[model samples]
Target: MTMPAFVKPRQVIGHHLVLRDATPADAEFIVALRTDESKSRFISKTSSDVSQQVAWLEKYAQDNSQVYFIMEDREHNPVGTVRLYDQQGDSFCWGSWVIREGSPSGYAVESALMVYQFALSLGFTRAHFDVRKGNESVWKFHERFGAVRTEETELDYFYSLSREAIDKSLAKYAKFLPGGIQVIAA
Candidate 1:
């Protein structure tokens, strides 16, 4: 199937959450999440300086190749962040997923479903991503979502989920997102 070029949406609404484009004002929240001692271990190290994060976000805003999102609760209170990038043909890589310590139980699953659903609507038929070797919970979550482990390096485990797998997940998790996702173009 021919896919149109990817266009970032202004907002993606899930059953219980909202994912909106990250702005420079979100630098502090993003920094805090990235710098969290427990969470930072698996991801790349980022500077603690908010201004540096702002600058990075500024650059990110100008780059249309990726969509960085701030995940929020239905009330619009920010709870986490995720990003979709590294498009290669019909597949895209997604990571930078992090939920706040006290978020409700299903945010991770819902946010992930939103990502897949939104991407599918944009014509991406497959998803590719990597998890740190030590991030057991996350990798296991992907496995449960039908992502097959495709490659393994000393430091990371790469995985992929085809359109079929993603479709299965959307069905299996229908209750968590009963109405499906709705993306409003930016």
Candidate 2:
């Protein structure tokens, strides 16, 4: 049997945010963005130096196992990033972060929606994420997007959403969204 395609590049937009894949030239910005203490807390890995970041970026450019996107404002200012990885079969793991302090509201939610839409476009049936413990706000945010808590472990809380759930959440939020929120297929 032939393996099915489950990945692709995509662009998504919200009222004040846009999400798209990172380019080779984004290494420097990514390095700076990931080094922030607040931003790095929830991330599983950290770059110790610029060279390390560059190497990671090079690998990311070549890797089919992961997809990364930079979140930007209306004026094209970078505010944060989101990544989807560990894709196997019909499930994938994902995460997002806002690198700049108080850059704007809605960065995380916009990034989340982008990733969810991307996953659906990729033929994924479900998506999952690990939220750090004690981050009640983040938990609530995920729940607001229709991610239900699926598992609780010593390190983090796991949440998941199926394609049906994602669609329902999007439809439910459509009335509250501004005119700019849209998911463009890759």
User: Number of the top candidate by TM-score?
Assistant: 1
**Error in Å for residue 103 of model 1:** 0.7
Model 2 — TM-score against the truth? 0.83
Q: Candidates' TM-scores?
A: 0.97, 0.83
Q: Per-residue alpha-carbon lDDT of model 1 for 3-66, expressed as tens digits?
A: 6356778999999999999999999999999898877888888999999999999999999899
Worst 10 residues of 1 by lDDT: 1-10
Q: Write down the lDDT that model 1 would get.
A: 0.92
Stretches off by above 4 angstroms in model 1 are none
Q: How many residue pairs clash (N, CA or C atoms closer than 3 angstroms) in each of the candidate models, in the order given?
A: 0, 0
Tens digits of per-residue lDDT for model 2 on 1-93? 333244545667766777777776777788787777777776666675777777777888778788788888878888877788876678788
RMSD of 1: 1.0
Question: How many collisions between residues are there in candidate 2?
Answer: 0
